[model samples]
Target: MTAGPYPPSMIGLSDVPVSNLAPPTGALVALAVAQFAAISWLGRRCEPALATDRWRRFLDDGNAPLMTVYLWHLPAMVLLVGAGLLLPDLILPDAGLHWWLIRPLWLANCALILVVLTRLWHRFETVRLPALGTRTGPATALAGTGLAAASIWYLWQHGATLNGAGSAGRIAAVLALGCSLVLLACGQPRTRRDAPVRGPELNVHPVRSGPAA
Candidate 1:
């Protein structure tokens, strides 16, 4: 999982001295901004009906199924992989598969997990929680929760290998996930209410009859 330089020992649980962790250039920031713009554009184009949406409104109205799906997918993949490892050799004989084919198997497992989770999500409507209060507050809370959880998981799983690139990727992924949660929270649908009608008085005008007379 380690990519790029900085040594494998630099990763893992070490009280390494603090140093400059900045990327080589401002390219990373520019890339992040570009990504955000692209995502915003795609959101508008894809969800035209919800174009005028706010993140808080979306979260409050209980329409964040994808967030749940994304959150659960990783764990599901881990479980599936573990189960696959335990399966009888006859069924999924590991005939010295190449690394390229192994990657495909991993992706297939992840996809299967997502499909199963999606079905479960549909059945329970767990994604549709009532808007608890102000959209910003709840959305922030959810983002914080997701970030904290992701951070803990990253440290636990890849703490030893968290070099510059890994750290950057982890931070980017967590931020993206947090933003998605916020968007989902803000994009909840509003409930419809009946509006009262006002009564009006009628006025009549008489036409001139000079020609007839």
Candidate 2:
């Protein structure tokens, strides 16, 4: 779907030749616009229902652990798919007669794996953030992000191992990644012992009458 004009996408849903087709640029653009319009209309229609406290809580329940799901979902899928390779007999061929039947099983297994992963990592999404080791400026944060992105791009182009051709580059990339993490970990200001908030002494206090008035 991504390849433009000349090489309009030839990919299919599966090994099914019936599903093969190319999407024209005009069609893709029009479809995208249509989708946006539909979503806008739906959002407007749903706002009143969604504004209720019950719906808000429901939305929050689904959204609160979304980050955890986003982080672990790909890994969970990769692990399951890789593990499937070891049990080839259980997996059907693409577009095979039993493939459709097995799809639900695949989804169920992936969901089970995702649930376990969510249980393990979702706490990070819900937990209160801890203080940073040191306060950092935007420049530091930007530098860290650039370094981290560069490291990922570098390794994605070269290889991760430092045993071969691009060894030096890979090593540099790893170092960049480490430095980025250090910079990113430094945003929190150090806690002062004389801090003015967040305790019975600050947010809450009891008044005492002077010497029985």
Candidate 3:
């Protein structure tokens, strides 16, 4: 099937004007099959203990900041693209061995930019809103969620642009983000201080002598 031009550096494809070109189906199929087979083989070969407690902790740490990464990765990429366009001499002119060598450097640059921006933007991702109480009921929550969902749908339908006909898309994105904040503000779990506490419970436990004495 035909495919549009994507970042050649990211996919390890040769520099070519791919806007009107279609990649070979056999090549795509082979790549897909190779990936699947490799993954399957690794999954079966690796021991379960490979995921130790330390590994799990590392995974958790990586996952914790992933929301920030996800939010800003696209923006970072856009910035990088803009930079490449502006600084053609420093970034362009890659050919033969130089082009291949620069690929890893370009990837590293993108990753470094992403990491730095993600750290800077991390606070916005962790914004906590006020907890929902009796005043803000489920109806309010539902309304906020509905509004957010509609906003997201509008943006998705409009291609997430703000130029030309996308001014309306920008409005939708704003509304969506606002509704999302509302949902988040009222979505926190109520602590015992906020919620009514039930009466104390009574229980009986049998005491045992140390090893039957």
Candidate 4:
């Protein structure tokens, strides 16, 4: 006899054995770690370039816009994807085109979403909070959390398959990935703040008598 919807041996699904899923690609993980390390090192080495007073002030004041971009891009991607699917005939014609072309169209849609979201977020005060002193830690944490939560929610809604037992595990994985990126970006040095300036003591010279005569 032929097997039913499920195999005859798998009558009781709960008792059936499940195969282990393969872990994520090691090559991608290694490349990401290397990229983060390189960026961190570059930022630290470039920190001295921002030593000038004016540029330092600007760097200290410009954290808000940067954070705003970091926080909204992923959610915007999801929105664009949904919009593209809903309006496929307009955004991407359903004519006799090669299937591979759809990938580039999807990328363009995502880029458009990113640009729109970044511009909108830049107008908000909360998105542009300063990154300096004690507030830096909290602000970084908050931004990281926001990005992570948004990514996880988006992935869950879109039904991305994961090795997780349920939604909680999938969310945790996405959040971890988002947090990693935030930490990496935060650790980068602000190159705009670097500027050379003479010290106050060097600028002033002691008045001396002519040959002490």
Best by TM-score: 2
User: Is candidate 1 or 2 superior in lDDT?
Assistant: 2
Question: What's model 1's TM-score?
Answer: 0.36
User: Which window of 10 residues has the lowest lDDT sum in candidate 4?
Assistant: 16-25
Which is the better candidate, 1 or 4, if ranked by lDDT?
4
What are the models' TM-scores? 0.36, 0.64, 0.58, 0.36
Q: What's the lDDT of the predicted structure labeled candidate 2? A: 0.78
lDDT of each: 0.60, 0.78, 0.70, 0.63
Candidate 2, which segments miss by more than 4 Å at Cα?
A: 1-35, 137-146, 159-168, 187-213
Candidate 3 lDDT, 1-213, residue by residue in tens: 334333233232235433222443445566689999999988777648557888788778888898888888888878887888987766765577766777888888889999999888787778885456434557767777777877777764554556775597677687677977666466455567887878888796997668753
At residue 40, what lDDT does model 4 achieve?
97
* Candidate 2 residue pairs in backbone clash: 132-188
How many Å off is the CA of 167 in candidate 2?
Answer: 5.0
TM-score comparison, 1 vs 3, better candidate? 3
Tens-place lDDT per residue, model 2, 1-213, is 435443334344334332223334465566679999999999999999899999999999998778888899889889888988988667634777677888899888888999999999887667877666657778998999999999998886565888777798899899989999989888856568536677555565788778974
Residue 75 in model 3: lDDT: 88
Where does the lowest 10-residue lDDT sum fall in candidate 2?
13-22
Tens-digit per-residue lDDT, 101-191, candidate 1: 6667768778888878877775676645767433345666676667667756665555434367578766665665566555545643434
In TM-score terms, candidate 3 sits at 0.58
Best candidate per lDDT, number? 2
